[model samples]
Target: MVIETLPARLDPEEAKRVRQERLERIGSWLLPLLIMLFAIWLWDRICVWNEIPRYILPRPHVVAQTLYTDAALLFGSLLVTLKITFLSLLLAVIGGVGLAVLFTQSKWVEMSFFPFAIVLQVTPIVAIFPLINIYVDNQTAKLLLCSWIVAFFPILSNTTLGLNSVDRNLRDLFRLNGATRWQKLRHLRLPAAMPYFLGGLKIAGGLSLIGAVVAEFVAGSSGQSSGLASRIIEAGYRLNAPRLFAALILISLTGILIFLVLSLVSHLLLRRWHESALKQER
Candidate 1:
């Protein structure tokens, strides 16, 4: 019997090259990242050298230290913000998709409600938050309602466009196959609408965060339970510049993480099927 050895794995040199390529990709991003860090550092240094009061501007290191010291409080506030955002987003997706389906089935309904959707999109959340607060009576409920209003439109618009925008040939084929409306929706429209839905989801994620912050800004001052916006407001009122800065940093990081997570989800869902995702390797 002939003994056949398996092919050797990547050699050290090849592995090193692969590592270098990854580092190079990361390195390409380094300059801009460093520039941002240096700018922050320089700003802090300048503020300190100018004898700027802590209330005016705190050092970056001081802000970072403050964050470390108050990690529990900061984290709790962050969790509250995240809860409102995600719950609102869940409601938006369900309601939006349901409305989209209704609109797709009824031209009259589409004509009646489409303009209202556009109106909602254009209206500032700040303008309506107080009304929602009054009607809802609970700060968290008002916040959720505001966030849902902000987030639902994108999903509705995108999914409706997708469902109704299917190719005529595909529709004809489905009809020829004796497919019911629901079957056509499930098999043909939904798969076709996934990209659009994902696009809307990305937009809605950011909008949800914005809605939460805006709602908190408008109505949370009197509430017992509050989100990160309250922490930011409290820090500012107390003239605790470092704490304020830390809260701001946390908010920024939260937004970035949401975007990153949504991006990854979009990639995972689309990579195998969508041309836009597959074009990367090409």
Candidate 2:
């Protein structure tokens, strides 16, 4: 017998839901770009209307031009800043995750050490930079230490919270199953802490950049190896607003890119099962 099968139809609600999701996805990218263009246009118009000199506030196009013209110098400084930011973030992740794991293992250790971490976090880098400079003579090491101090606390605190936030029932179940500490950590706590760790990492990424820039500002060390902050300072001294704006743009773009990359990592890692990254059927 030959049978003809008709094509299945999607549910009306599901079709509407899919369309909404698509629109939302498109809007997410489109809206920010539109707003940015509008802002740039307004800025250019304001500069033209007021006859403002480029020395004070260069038009966006002028800044763009400067970026193109000074790409080599700007990018070199960017590379230096990026190196410190990334290195600090890496160290923060290692130290924070390791310490958090240790905290989970023992309350006494956490009580003894967590306060020092808190002190480091709460104390302004500027306040401690003098001491750092006095003791650590290397410019690069100072930048790394300052950035690491700024980035370290978020990861440590967030990961600690996540590790301790495990569901009692689930933990009891694991215990009932005769799971070892390592097994429980590997299978349960780590997975549970993933979201928190990612959240902290996103914050730390921006903080690392800020710390690197601030450290550079404090160091005030001139030369080719200096970061974007040095360029900003030099531009200020020379009254070269365009170059300063260009440097600022690079820093802003760098921060945005770091955030986007970390967010993508978080979404990719969590989307499979975690609620925060999962798409809701609203």
Candidate with top TM-score is 2
Each model's lDDT comes to: 0.87, 0.93
Residue 163 local lDDT, model 2: 93
Residues 120-237 of candidate 2 have per-residue lDDT tens digits of 8999999999899889877899899999999989999999999999999999999999999999999999999999999999999999999999999988753544799999999999
Q: What is the lDDT of residue 233 in candidate 1?
A: 88
Candidate 2 pairs with clashing backbones: none
Over the stretch 1-282, how does candidate 1's per-residue lDDT look in tens digits?
233663478788877876997998898999789999899989988997898887889878888899999999998999999999999999999999999999988899999999999998899889987677678877788889998999999999999998888989999999999999899989999889888988998899888988888788887677575688899888888998888888888888988888889889988999888876774330
lDDT for position 208 in model 2:
97
State in Å the error of residue 245, model 2. 0.2
TM-score of each: 0.89, 0.91
The candidate 1 region of ten consecutive residues with least summed lDDT is: 1-10
